[model samples]
Every structure is written in C-alpha cells, then in structure tokens.
Target chain A: MPDKRCTEDEVVAELADGMTIGIGGWGSRRKPMSLVRAVARSSLRDLEVVSYGGPDVGLLCATGKVRRVVYAFCSLDSIALEPHFRRARQDGTVETFELDEGMMLLGLQAAAWRVPFLPTRVGLGSDVLEHQRDRIRTVRSPYDDGEELVAVPALPLDVALVHLHRADAAGNGQYLNVDPYFDDLFCRAAARTFLSVERVCPTEELASNGPLQSMLISRLWVDGVVEAPFGAHFTECVPDYPRDEEFQRAYAAAARDDEAWAAWRARYLDCGGHDAYRDAAGLR
Target chain B: MSGPAASVGPGPATRADHCVVALAECFRGDGEILANPIGTVPMIAGRLARASFEPDLVMTDGEARLVAGPVPVGVEAPDVIVEAWNPYRTMFDVVWSGRRHVVMGASQLDPFGNHNFAFIGDRRRPRAQLLGFRGAPGNTVNHATTYWVPDHSPRVFVPAVDVVCGIGTDRARALGPSGRFFELRAVVTNLGVLDTSGPDGRLRLRAVHPGVAPEDVQAATGFLLPMVDDLEVTRPPSAAERVLLARIDPLGLREREVRTS
Candidate 1:
C-alpha cells in the first residue's frame, strides 16, 4: 500500500478549471475549510461546485471562483441563510442546479453505483423537475406497476474534498462525531478524493480511536490524506471544538459590502497559507 | 365553550403559548412516528406533544440519536437517553417509508398549501434568495407534512408561491398513485390553525387563537381562506401541557420566535 500523505497545495494542484468538485459536510458543520481556502486562493475558474453547502459555497462564490453551483441548500444553519451565497444567487453570479436533498443523495449514489441514473419519486410534481427540465428527466417503471419516477442523474465529480477527525498514512479516515453527513458518498462518487484530517496517526492508533462504524472512508477510496489541524475551523468538528459563532458572524457581516468583504478577504482568506490562516483567524 | 384551565406555574398562556399548543395539537393523533420539527416554536411543540399527551412520538437530539425523552431547546450534547442512531442517510429510509411527520417553517405558502422556501420573486434572478428547496420537496411528497408560520401576514400566505418546493394538494392529486402518501396535515401560525379540508382541497381556517378574529386572519392572508362552519378558537395550553412546555423550553426561547405583544 502506498503512503497517500500530501499537502493542501498538492490537492489544489490536481484540480483544474471547469471541474466539478464535491465538498463534504452539511450546512456549516465539519467542512474542509483549509482546502476550500486553498481553492479560493488559487486561480481556479469556471468550477462547478457541488455541496450540501455552507461557507464553502459562499467563500468560493465571494472569491469569484465558481461558475456554477449544484446544491440542495446553502445555509449557515444558525443564521438561516448564508449571506454571501444569498448575494451570489440574488446577483445571478452563478448558474444553479438546485435539487431536493434526497435527489442530490440519489445522484451521488447513482455515480457511486456506476449507474446512469437512479429513479425516485422525490421531485415529481415540484418545481425541481420544472427548473432542471434539461438535466433531470422522468422515467416510467418497466415493471407491472408502471409508476413514473424522477431519474436523478449521476453526479460524477472530478474531485471530492472532505475533512475527517482522524486518518492514517495509508489514507483510512474516521469521524469522531455523531453524524458522518454524506462524506463517504462524496468520496465514492468522485474520481479522486482528498481527505484533510485533524491528525495523521499510525494505522494502529487510528483503529483504536473510535468504534468500527466511525471508520467512514477506507484506504481504497482515498487518493490523498493531508493532515491540517483545525482544518474544519469556524465549522463545528464536535469533540474537538464547536463552530466559532463570533468568527462566522464576522464572516457574515463582511458579506454586507464589497469594501468589508475585501478587508475580510485580505485578513483571512488571502493570508499566505494554512498556518497563516490559523494565525489570522486566531484559532487556538 | 370556555378555554382550558389557566396555565399553571407559567402564568396565563400568552399568544406564543397558544401557538405552541396549537402546533403541538397538530401531532395529537400522530402515534409512534418521527416528529421532526424545524424552527423554535415547532421544536417546543414537538417536545410538548411527546412529554404531555403523545408519549409514543419519536424525537431527535437535533443531531443523530433517536432520543427516548424530549431534549430541551438550545442545549448542545445534553445527557440523552438514546433509542436508536439515525444519521442523515438513514433519515431518508424513514422519510420514504411515510413514517415521519415534519412541522417545517414556510417563507411563502399558497392557497393549496404549496410552499416556497427556495427563493422569492423570479427564479432567474431572485429578489431574496432563501434556503433553497431543501428537504421540503421530499418531505411533502413522502409523508404527512405541516407548516409553522410565526408571522401570519400576506407576505407569507401568498396567492401563488414563486417556486413550489412542497407539492400542494392540486399537484399531488395530479400525480395519481405516485403522490399517495402526500398529506398537507395542518398549517399552524401565530394567529390561527388551518387545514386543507375546504372545497377542492383549499385552505380552510380551522380555528383562531384567543382574541384574534377570523376577519383578522382573512385580512392578513393574500388569498381568500375558507372558514370552517364550526369555527373554534384555539385553546390555550392546559395545566399539564404548560408544565411540559416549561420543562421543554426553560429559557423562554419560544417567546422570542413569535410575537408575545
């Protein structure tokens, strides 16, 4: 087995323009902010970002890196709406392929299963079918029942970026939290998967960290494992720390104006690298 | 008929209390099913229902576990008695099985109970971009769904929603057998309780809260709301219900969600 250890820069280096990148985590919880910031800082353009979005979508949209967004909802959980993503949507800055949350799940499942599409009754009569008429299609069941279902197309991604609590040198990842929110599906659905963890422990210690079920991402699915401490900063990583509400508030406040955003971008996102970002963000 | 006995320990029931009771009553006969409630008032209501009358109702710790008892509001990682582990992935299994009853918030709801939390104004360029069509589409179609509107104004109770996230009665009926499980159970707002039991499955005013007039509800609504013949006033929380409400929401978070004035 190969040691899949890499850097955030190396993960970002593999990404190309116009690629569909799936981001793991839901709402404002346990996002790969380090690699997201790296993507934002890089010159990546015309990217189609897929996510159960939080500030990852908002930050990318604010940095003008995203050309399209494939999402169910972009929320800041506690704040209801993500300010930057709201602004982007209101401004029509990025084309959106919004589907039902279940539909998005099915799409990822379809890709993981190597199927063209998965049929479901989630978006049948809703505007989800009407809005994504070109992309999402309906298929009648071939069996005797003959029920019409929405065929959620496979969302095959070029790359997947996820943040787990711990991993090994061989790229086996584990989540210490209660909910492993679609991280494994995102990894399995993508061609390449990069995991950023709080710590890179030995394979023996990794197995002893938590229950067997906590081992979400296996070594076979992962391409790289980057050990970035506080990698999911500002987002809650449970057992480690809660979401920095004050920092998130500041981030939301900055989205009010371009001047405020510019100042914020310079102070946090544009500050050299991950180590500097932690220093600027005052992450302890 | 007179209202229920004056609320015990918590003083007389305020508008928020009435709203919570009304919201809780939505799950009255919902025996032994997942009572997934969004927002502050609905969360309190869900717990209130479970703690008081509907003990069989299943609740979550707002994360993963299917908690045996009702967890209090705003308390992160409290000592909970776990029933089962339900992650986001497993939630869909429950959703698809029609075993869940969700009380969600609505940004805009039409006459036929079509909900829109996706965006306001045009889809091409929205005037206000809210949380996109999240689980609403799936939730409404999958199982019995209800809405809790803190503010009952024309802005929220609209004639036609900009984007239909939750399939309404009209659309659901059109889908034939596919939309079999679709049920717009109830709509509990600050002012009153409504149900889609009117002619042609239109929204009908089921009851009004104490002091609020039927005309007031009609005036606030963008569309004409058909009134039920036996128009009843929404009952205030009973003594036992109030006691449960206090335990479920000790910090008075429900008061902040709705207008007490």
Candidate 2:
C-alpha cells in the first residue's frame, strides 16, 4: 500500500474552485478544523459545501469561499445557532439546499451506494420539498404499495475532509469517540477524501488503539492523510479534549461585526498555518 | 384557580416544576420508545419521565449512547450505564422506525402544530436565522413528535408558522397513507399544555399551569386557542417527583432554562 501522508495545505491544494466538498463531523464535533482553516486561508472560490455544519460552514461562508451550502442545520450545539452562518444566510450570501437531516443522510448514502437517488418519506409534508423542489423529486414505489417518497438525490462530492483520532500513513482512519457521525459516508461519497488525524500510528496500532468498529474510514476511500495534532481543535475529540467553549464563544462574538471578524480572522485564520493558529489561539 | 399553589410535599412547586411534570407526562405511555428531548426543560422532562413513571422509555446520554439509567443533567461525567451505542448515523434507523418520541423546541408554532425553526421572515433572506430545517421535517413525519416551548408568547404561538419545518395536522393529512406514522402528540409550554386533539386537529388549551387562566394563555397566543371543556390545572411535581427532579438535575439547570416571572 502507498503511504498517502500529506500536509493540510497539500489537501487544500488538491481542491479546485466550484468543487463540492463534503465536511465530516456533526455540528461542531470532530471537524477537520486544520484542513478547514487551510481552506479558509486559501483562495478557493465558488465552492459548494455539504455538511452537518458547524464552524466549518461558518468559516467558509465568512471567508467568502462558499457559493452554495447543502445542509440540514448549521449549529454550534452548545450555541443554538452558528453566528457566521446565520449572517451569511441573512445576507443571502450563498444559495442553500436545506433538507431534512434524514434526507441529507440518505443523499450521502445514495452517493456512497453509487445510486442516483434513495427514496424516503422524510420530507413528505414539510417545506423542504417546496424549498428544494428544483433538486429533490418524488418517486412512486414500483411495487403494489404505490407509496410516494422523496427521492433524495446523490450528494456526490468532489472532495471530502474529515478529522479522526488516529490514522495510519496508508489512510485508514479511526475515531476514538463514541459517535463517528457520518465521516465514513462522506469519504465514500466523495471522489477524493483527505483525513486529518491527531496522530499517525502504525497500521497495526490502529487496530489496538480502539475497537474494530472505531475503524471508520478504509484506505480504499481515502486519498491523503495529514497527521495534524489537535486537528479537531475547538471541537470535541473526546478522550483527547473537549470543545474549547471559550474559544468558540470568542469566535461567535467576533462574527457579530465586520471589524471584530477582521480582527479575529487576522489573529486566527490568516496567521500563517495551523500551528500558528493554535499558538495564536493559545492552544498548547 | 390561583397559580402559586402548594404541592403535596417539599417546597411550593415553581412554575418550572409544573412545566417539567407536564412535559414528562407527554411520555407517560411512550413505552420502550426513544425519548429524544432537545432543550433544557425537555431534557429534564425526558429524564424525569424515565426515572419515575415511564421507566421503559429509552434515553441517551445527550451524545451517542443509549443510557440504561437517567444520567444527571449538567454533570460533565456522570456515571452512565450504556445499553447500546447509537451514533448519529445509527439514530436514523431508530427515527425512521417510528419508535422515537421527541420533545423539541420551536421558534414558531402555529395552531395546526406546524413548527418553524428554520428561518423567520423569508427563505431568500430572513429577519432572523435560527437552526435550519433540521430533523423536524423527518421527526414529525416519522414518529411521535412534541414541542416544548419554554416561553409561551404571541411571537412563538403564531397564527401561522413562516416555514413549516415540522409537518402539521393539515399537511400530514394531505400525505394520506404516507403520513400514517405522523403523530403530533403534545405541545408543552411554560404557561400551559396544549394538544391538537380536537376534531379539526388544531391546537386546543388542554390545561393551564397553576394561576395561569385559559384566557391568559389565549391572550398571549397570536391566535385564539380552542379550550378543552374540562380544562384543568397542570399537575405540579409531587414530593417524590421533586426528589427525582433534584436527583436528575442536581445543578438546578432547569431553573435557568425556564423563568416563571
């Protein structure tokens, strides 16, 4: 097997403009913040981000990198709403395809299964159908039942960025936390996938680190691996550390105004690289 | 009846305690189903239900595990007995199975029980941007759904929701057999307990908290709420229930979430 280890910048370098990028993690937990920071600092434009969004979507929207967002919700968990993403939506900065959470999951699953769409009854009577009428279509069952269900289209992505607790140079990733979210699905649904991990362990150690079920991402689906410690900073990585509530509060506070955002961007986002961002944010 | 009534035991039951018990009563018969409560009071209510009356109800640790026991609220690392691992992905299996009863918060709720937490004004650009159309669309359509509104005001109890994130009685009825599993169980607010159990399937004043008159609830609502003929006061937490509430919420986080004043 090839050693697919790369830098966060290298992962960002592989991404192109107008690409659909699937971000892993569910609402501010286990996000690839290092890689997301690299994307924020990069000149990538007109990107469509699909996520169970948190600050990843917020940062992308704040940096003017996103042209569209396909999401169920963009929340900070503890913080009810993500401020930057809220501002972006309020300003009509990006086009949105807001689906039911289950619909989004089915879409990703459809892509991973190499199917055009997966039929479900999630968005039947909600405004989701009205909002996403252009993209989502209904299909009647071919069987005797003839029940109509929402055909959640494949959410195929150009690239996927995920953060895991540990990974091998061969690109197999494992999550130490209880919930793996949808990182594996994101990786399989994307054409290319990059994983950033807290540590790069030997392939054998990956199995020993945790249960076999924790090994979520297979090397077959991953294109690159970046060993960026605290890669999921500000987000909870469980046994390693919890979410930096204070830092997240500061981030949310900055999004209140352009000047505050600019100051925060300079102090954090534009500060050279991931290591510098950590140092500036006082993350030891 | 006046609002501040004495409880069966312990201290006088605050309005928050009444709301908690009312919210807990929402899951009284939801045996063995997953009780996924979203907000603070709802969380307390879910645990309260599980700890006391509805012991068969499944509860999570507010993260990923199906906890066998009621984990204390606001405790960083409470001793939890893990029954099963329920990741976000795996949760869909439970959600779609119609085996879950969720008590979620609503930014805007209408007489028909349609909820809107997506956006306020318009789809293109709204006045306020709340949590988008999350699991509301799916949850409402799939299983038993309830709403826990900590604040019951004209703003929340709207005439009609701006966006229907959760399918109401009207929309669900339109789906025919597709909406077979849809059940808008109840809506528990700070002021009173409301339900869409009327013949027309519209929100009706089921019961008011102690001191809160049915007229007061209707006055605070954006539209006139139909009153149940036998409207009664919401049950206050008993001394045993209060002890359980304290055990579940040792930090008194429920008080912070709901303010009677």
Candidate 3:
C-alpha cells in the first residue's frame, strides 16, 4: 500500500493555480477547512472551486483565490447568506456557474463515471437552461424521439478535498454522521483526492468501529491522508462537535467590514495552521 | 371559553410567532409528507407544523437522519430519536417520488409565483451570484412547494424574476402535462400570506398579517396582486399551536429572524 499519510502542507502543495477543485461538504457541514485555509494562505490564484458551499467558498472568494465558483448553495446554514460570497457576488469579484443541486450532482456523476454528459429532466423549464446554456444542452431522448432531456456535461476536477469523522492510515474514510454529502462522488471525479479527517486511527479500528454504509471512500481512491483533528472547525463534523455558531457569527460580522475581517484574519487564520487557529480562538 | 389569555391569539408572543404560525398554517392540509425547510424560519415552521396538527410530517435533522420528534434548531440535542437514516442520495429519491414539500426562501418572487434566489443582472455575466438553483427546480416540479420571505418589499415581490429557480403557474401551464406534479402552494411573507387563486391562477392576497393592511401589501408588491373580496386576517397561533411552537423553539430564535417592527 502506498503510504497515504502526509502532512497538510504536502496536500496543499499538490494544488496549483487555476485548477478546478471540488470541495466535499454540504454547505457548512464537514468541510475540509484545514486544506481550505492552506489554499487561502497560499499564493494560488484564479482557482475554480466547486462545492456545496459554506465558509470555504467565502474564504476563497474573500481572499481573491477563486476565479469562478460552481455551487448549489453558499449559505452558512443558520446564517442564511455566506457574507463573503454574497459580497463577492454583489461586488462582481468572482464568476459563478449556478446549477440546481441535482444537476450539480449529475455533473459530478458524469465525471466520476467518465461519461461525456448525463441526461436529466431537472432543469427543463427553469432558467438554469438559460443561464448554463453553454455547458448544458437540450437533447431529444433516443428511446422516445420527442422526449427532451437536459444534457448536463461532466465537471472534471483537478483536485478534491474532503473532511470526514475518521480515517485509517491507508486513507479509508469513515463518516459516522447522518450523511456523507457527495465526498465519494467528488473523490471519483477528481484527478487527485486529499482526505483530511478528525483523527487517523489503525485500519483494524476502522473495520471494527465504523458503520458499514458510512464508509464512503476507499483507500484506493485517496491520494493523501492528513490527520486534522478539529479540521472542519466552524463547520459541523457530527459525532465530533456541533457547528461553532459564535465563531460563524463573528466571521459573518467581520466579513461585513474590511478592518474587522483583517483583524479577525490576522488573529485567527493568518496565525498558523489548525492548531494555531484553535489556540488563538481559545478553542483548546 | 374561560382559559389563560396568554395561551392563544393576541398573546404576548412577538410578530415572529405570528409569522411562524402563518407559515405553519400553509402545511396544515399536507399530511404524511416530507417537510424540507431550507432556512431557519422555514425549518421552524416545518417542525412546528410537525409537532402540532401535522403529526405525520417527516423532518430531516438538518444533517441526514430522520427524527421521530422535533429536534430544536441549531442546538445539538443528545437523545434525538433516529427513526431512519436519510442520506443525501435518499433525499433525491424522496424529491423525485413527489413525496416532499419544501418551504424555500426567495430573493425574488414574481406575480406568477416564480421565484429567484440564484443570480441577478444579466444571465451571461451576472452582476451578483446568489445561491445556485439548489433543488428549487426539482422541488417545484416534483412535489409541493411554498415560499417564505422575511422582508416583503417591491424588490422581492418583483414583476419578473431575473432567474427562475422554481417554475410558477405560467411556466407550469406552458409545460402542459409534463408539469402535472408542480404545486406552487403559497407565499408566506412577513407582511402576509400569498397564494394562487381566481380564474387566471395568479398570485392573490390570501390573508394579511394582523397589523398589515391590504394597501400595505399592494404597495410593497411590485406586481399587482389579485385581492380576495373578503380578505381574512391571518390567524394567530391557537393555544395548542403556541404550546407546540414553544417546545420546538424554546430559545425564541424565531423572533430574531422575523422582526416585530
């Protein structure tokens, strides 16, 4: 087995400027914040981020790292609108490819399965056809000549980042929570996969303790595994911690003001990695 | 009816409570359906509805688990009864099967009940990127859908949406039989409740909030709303509904979203 265990820096080093990155998490839940922070701090620019967005999108947008964002939603769950993403959009800082949640999934699915395009009826009458007309096309079904479907093209990604509850040294991920989001699809779709977990346990522990169905990602797919305890900070990694609402609120408030965000970023995110963030935020 | 006056309408509850009650009322007749409320206020309404009269309404724990009882919003409850495991994929199954009823937020809602929370300005190069059309298209086309707008203004209640996330009466009609399952149920705003009625099936004044007048709703709306001859005042929560809402939302977080002023 290839030694998948590596440092967070090694994972970030794999990324380059202007790459199409698929981030796994549903909005503010189980986001790979460690990798996200690494990217934010890096010199990487003009990156295209694909995510069921949360703070990761906001952070990248706020830092001017992202050239385009493809998302179903960008709200911070309870906070409603992700302030940074909203501001970025309103200010015309970043471009976006808006897809219906299902269509977004289909796009990932097409890439994962190595298909050119997948047909769907989701965005038939809606303006998604109007907006993403370049990427999507109206096609008549072969089975029934008159039956029309939307051909959603594949969103081939350069890298995929995901945070899970736990993983083994070989990178077999275990999500003890309710949903796995689209981590598996993301891993399959991306050229490279970086798996960050709250803890890295022995392979035997993963077999004995983890739920059979929640074991979404196989080690064969994971290129690197970085042990990032509390990695999905501010976002909920269920069975670990609830979402840090106070910090999320503070982040939102700070996002409204450049000075406040600067001070907040300097004190927390700019300090160091996850441990430094923890210490600075008085987390532990 | 000699009872505690505080238990029912005209009670000490804020406008938020009344707004929640109105939103909950939208799901009153909807029995044994999946209540997928995307935002905080809508989630409150769904949970409140489930806890009260609409007992059979199923709710996701905002993660993936289907809960047997109402789990408080944003609070991590320790002993939540996990009735079933509802993964993200299974959610799509529920959506496709016409089994779910979602109460979604709207950045812009038109006279035909079309909603947009996706993008603003030109389609090719949008001036602003809102949420990508997240499940709104499928949800509106698949099953029943209701909208909740915290701020009722001419901006939200627009003449035409910049982007159509959810199909309205006009588009549904254009689709003919393919749009058979489309049910744009109601629009619950801070000011009042709007629904489709009359011969044309356009947005109509269902009921105005207690302090809100018909003229107030008309003035706030960018498009002309067909008002009912006998416009009823939105009902305040009954004693039972109030008690249920209190249990679901003990922190009174609903008030913060729906302003009394």
Candidate 4:
C-alpha cells in the first residue's frame, strides 16, 4: 500500500501520448476538474477521453488535447452543444464515438469480468452496429441454435482518473452522493488508476456513517489520490454542493459571444494551474 | 404518417388513434431502457404525455404495472429476459425499431451508426457508464433516429470517436446506405427537432418546441443547421395524458425536474 502522498503532477505523470484515458464526472457533476487540468498541462498527446457527460471532456476538446472521445452522453444535458465537439464535427478536427449509458457500463463490465465480451440485444438493429463493427462480432451460439448475438470485445485501459468525495493515503476513496456506479469497477479493471478527492482520511471514517460502506476503493487498485474541493463546480455534484447554476448561466451567456468567451477563457483557463486561477478568482 | 407532423393534430378532422400517435410522444418503454443519458426515460414519458397518449403505458416501474390500464399490481422483480413476452418488447422492438419515429439519446454516436453504452472511455474509470450503447446501433437502422440532447455542447460531439457507439450518416453511407435505417433520423431538443435529407446531409430544423423560437434553436445549435419553411411547436401534455403519465410513473418520475428549460 502507498503510505506517502504524491503531488498532482506526480499523479498524472504516468500518462503518455495516444493514451486511452477514462475521466471522472457525470453531466459535470462529481467530475474531478483538478485532475482534468493536470492532464491538460501534461505533455500527453492524442488522449482518448471517455466520459458520461460534462465540460471536463469539453475542456480537453477545447484545448485540443483530445484526439478522440468515447461517450454515452455529452453536453450539459442539451443546454447547448459542447463548442469543441461541435466545431470538431463541423471542422473534422477530432474523432468521436457514441454509446448509450447502460451499454457503456456493460462493456466495462465485460472487461472487469475478464470475459472476452458479453452478448446483448442492446443495439440489435441500429446504426450503433456499423461503427462498432470491430468491437462487436456476430457469432452463432450453439446453445441458442443459430441465434445471432452481438459480442462486444474486452476493453481494458491504461489508466482511470476517478474523482471522489474522500480518500486516504492508502487510496480508499468514498463518494458523497450519486453512488456513481461503474467507476469503481472501471478503476479496478484498469492497469493504473488515479483518484482525486475532496479529502483523504482514515477509511474507517467513511465506513462510520456513509450509506455505502461496502463500495470503498481498495488500496491496491488506486495509485494516487489528490484532494479537490469544488472540483465539480461548473459541473456540480448535488447535496454536498449544488451545481453553480450562476456559472452555468454565465457560461451559457458568454459561450455564444466570441469576445466574451475569449475573455472568460483567458481569465480562468489561460493561467494554467487550478491554484493560480483559483487564487485569481478568489477561490481556494 | 405521410403528411406533415403538424397538420395531424387533435380537434375534429383527425382520427382519435392518429391524434394520439401523430403527436410525437414517448411510448416509459422500460423493457429495453438504457439507464444513462439518465434522462431518456422521463423524456419519453414527457413526450408521450405531450402527445396526449394517456394510455397507461407498460412499465418496469409504476401504478398498475400493466399496459394502458390501472390495476393494484405492484411491480414484481421478474427477469425481463425471462418474461420475453413483456409488453415493453413491442415498445423497443416494434415501436423504436418499427416504422414509427423515435427520439433517443446516447453518450457517443459514430458515423457508422454503431454506438457504445459499454464503457465511457476506459471503461475502467468511467465517470458515469451508461447502459452500453444499449440499442442505439440496432435501433438506428430500424427506426427514424432522432437523437435527444439533454446535454448538447461542444465536447460531446466529436470528429472521430474513441469508441463507435452508434452509426451516423457518414458511417451509414460507408456501410452502403441502401435504406434510411442506418443514419441519425433527427435530433430533438428543448429547442427543436433536427433532421436532414440528400447525400451531404445538413442537420435541419424540422420543428421547434413551444416557447422556443426558431432563432433560439439556431442560437443553441452548433452545426450547419437547416431550417424548414416553418417550424411547429412540440405539443404539451393534456389532462388525460397527464393522468396516465401520473398513473404509470407516480412519484418515480413525476417530481424529477427537467435539466433543460
């Protein structure tokens, strides 16, 4: 078990170019923005980012750090299209992939389960098949007597960047809300995993009161843990804290105005590290 | 079904059955429901209600637990596969894949119409792994695919996808587009409906929702959007539709607020 604390850079240092990286967040909620920025600063190129939905992936796309993306849901739930994704599609800058929310989980589950793939009727007859032709193969099962099944191949990753509510030096992380299914399995299935949390404490503390005690992150599966607060601000995690609706409104208002957007990016995103920007913005 | 989607409304000149299905509605369909995109369920319910199809739709969760009628039956934990003859089978197989039009959502939709709901990216550390590209690839080739964007923004739409979850027009063409099933049928939103025609398909505005202007739809979109001669407002829920929606969803979905305005 790791007994020492690593800096943010140390946590993300292992990433290399053309790496397939899974990010943390759900519709901007519970996302680890600190880690996303850390990846942004890194020399990694052609990073393949997979996420459920949020601005973190958008930020990667916006910065041109992302070469391609695998997503189930993107956008802040249709408030508007993500700018980078839209521009890329219109401009053909990056490659994109789409999936349904549950199917994403099952694909991961196939990897976690150590199965080559799981056959499902999820996309039995849609456009999803044409693109996933490589990943999905149709094999006739003898048991089913010539029944055609869509098999999704095993998807293993190099690293998983998971953000959480709390963790310790040993990497036992806890979530505040949104039980956040699949993230744990995702981390466990990866070769290396980095965790960003709001606090790192004794695992016992998390076990003491949290509704979910059995789902704590084990030490062996996590390599690093960085504490992050208000990490999912523009993309918010509820109850512990609400999404910054005001920020969303501001972003929405400014995103459409090029000058306003440029100014906003310069003020917040241009400065580099979260601390400098946070300090400048009067945050922690 | 052949005429414009707008002229087929409920007043007098319309057949009652046509009046119901004519208005685009979500038929709570749970048999093949994918859990993420997290909003498709409510969306379907909302659209169905808006169309005034007040029939107690079949559900995996709800009031009577039957299709289009009320009973005191609580939802039992029965295996969906075990109950292959489920009332919802028709919803996913026939309705979404049938000749009817549908507006579903996805995490990633690719050019080939192959979608992924399997893993977000690494699958190892998915922030939120939705139901693996559930029925997107299959459904697209079967129905009029109108992708809904509860979260439409730049980062989500990409040039080349890390994983192909569903096939798009380009991919459909690459796969040799003999039929219209393989391409994205449309894109529905709080703002409007996006559809297209011809080889170099441009996402066009088919219809705008109530309170949402044509310009608002234009303001929200980020692609080469096409506008129809005139757009119609998405129909809202009626009294009977609301009652059925309530009966089927009860508290399970009623209180959930819409992410979009």
Q: Which numbered prediction scores highest in DockQ against the true structure?
A: 2
DockQ of each two-chain model: 0.83, 0.85, 0.54, 0.14
In candidate 3, stretches whose alpha carbon ends up further than 4 angstroms from where it belongs are A269-284, B1-21, B38-41, B51-53, B70-79, B119-130, B209-212, B236-239, B249-261
lDDT of 2 by residue, B127-207 (tens): 888989999988999999999988899999998899999989989999999999999999998899998976679999999
- The CAPRI-style docking tier of model 3 reads medium
* Tens digits of per-residue lDDT for model 3, A24-101: 998889999988998998889999999999999999999999999998889898887788998888777888787889
How high is the DockQ of candidate 2? 0.85
Comparing 2 and 3 on TM-score, the stronger one: 2
Off by over 4 Å in 1: B1-7
Candidates in order, TM-scores: namely 0.97, 0.97, 0.89, 0.60
Q: Which model scores highest in lDDT?
A: 1
Q: Whole-model lDDT for model 3 versus the true structure? A: 0.85
Predicted candidate 3 versus true structure: per-residue lDDT over B110-166, tens digit per residue = 888988988788754567767768899888888999999999999999998998999
Sort the candidates on lDDT, descending order: 1, 2, 3, 4
What lDDT is obtained when candidate 1 is compared to the true structure?
A: 0.91
lDDT for each residue of candidate 4 in B185-256, tens digit (9 for 90 to 100): 455444555565523664566666555677765555443355777666555545455444344333333223
Model 4 Cα lDDT, one tens digit per residue, A140-194: 5677355555675656677888877778778887776634645786786677888
Candidate 3 displacement at residue A175 in angstroms: 1.6
Worst 10 residues of 1 chain B by lDDT: B1-10
| lDDT against the true structure, each candidate | 0.91, 0.90, 0.85, 0.55
lDDT of 1 by residue, B182-259 (tens): 999999998999999988899999999988999999999999899999999988888767767666777778878877
- How far is B31's C-alpha from truth in model 1 (Å)? 1.2
